[model samples]
Target: MKLGACYVAKDNELKPLREDAYFICNKEQTLDVVDGVGGWAAKGGDVGEYARQLMANVIIAVHEEYMLKRSVDLRRVLHETYFHTKVEGSLTSCILTFKASLLHAVNVRDNGDRPDMAMELVVRVEAGDIVVLGIDGLLDNMYPTKMEEILKRETKGQAGSVCLKKVAQQGMRCTTRLTSLHSLHSLKLQKRQD
Candidate 1:
């Protein structure tokens, strides 16, 4: 497996903080992205703090699980990490694990309530397949065809940076839209044959 990642903060004066966080555990072939709920800022919360803490706890939980020789159960990991994260804001989380040519994904959107269950999915992948993960900043701004075109022009190692740059440019051009660019983060993973 080969992975590349990139992050860009929102280029706005009013909201200078970037509220997205990501984690990559190469040893366990796991990746996580958390987006802090910007609405919390209206309630006097530090929008980015909760996401940062949640990602930090996810790293700890993943390492602990690996050290204990436990299987990569994304649901358990999410549940463990969510409860352990005692921060003041809400967030949306996406966790992914790659094993034996299969990708396991768990996604949760916190609606100011305790997250009881997450949406889960498993998909089989093949060598040379590419998996892209990003927060809404990137997804909402760029079209699928545009993203595919950019990725198709880059090598595996360059995909992350190139995609981020292209997406950020697109977001800048669309600044007149209702939703200005939020923090943008992207992870590009390519399956390689051993």
Candidate 2:
């Protein structure tokens, strides 16, 4: 049974979609949700387009190859691409696979060793978990932790729409926080250099 969920959307002008998307499907008794990070398809790059094509083929291959085995291997679905002549920038993604309670995930990021900076979150998602997918325009400001708290507090038994409305109320706050974080990071980097 495919009980996994996924979401992807444009977060900024720097590659509106950033090539990240997630999906869940059954592979035998285990289920795997693959998170894909699309490469930069900037002014003269094909990362975005190629990433999508690569992912599509990979997903199909996974289903065909792993369905009978019932176990989802993260390494099997993930492969790294090296560039020789082109300046290739890659985005990061996270995938989670599970069976009843067993969970496994694969995460790839544009920023090395910084999975936390990316927007993908794979927690113990409930049947009631409200999955919100939007561009950085909406989330770049507010951190995921805050969003989770807001949703938990304001939308106990309400619908997803109501929860999202409450989240919207805090959009400005998110923007402020984003700016603050940016400033702080910059300052820290400057201090290191000094």
> In lDDT terms, which candidate is top?
1
Top of the candidates by TM-score: 1
Question: In model 2, which residue pairs have backbone atoms overlapping below 3 Å?
Answer: 11-136, 19-38, 28-70, 92-108, 92-109, 93-108, 141-174, 142-174
Q: Per-residue alpha-carbon lDDT of model 2 for 71-125, expressed as tens digits? A: 6554454431111113333433334455464444444444343323323223454
Model 1 — TM-score against the truth? 0.82
TM-score of 2: 0.51
Which runs in model 1 stand beyond 4 Å of their true positions?
A: 12-17, 112-116, 175-194
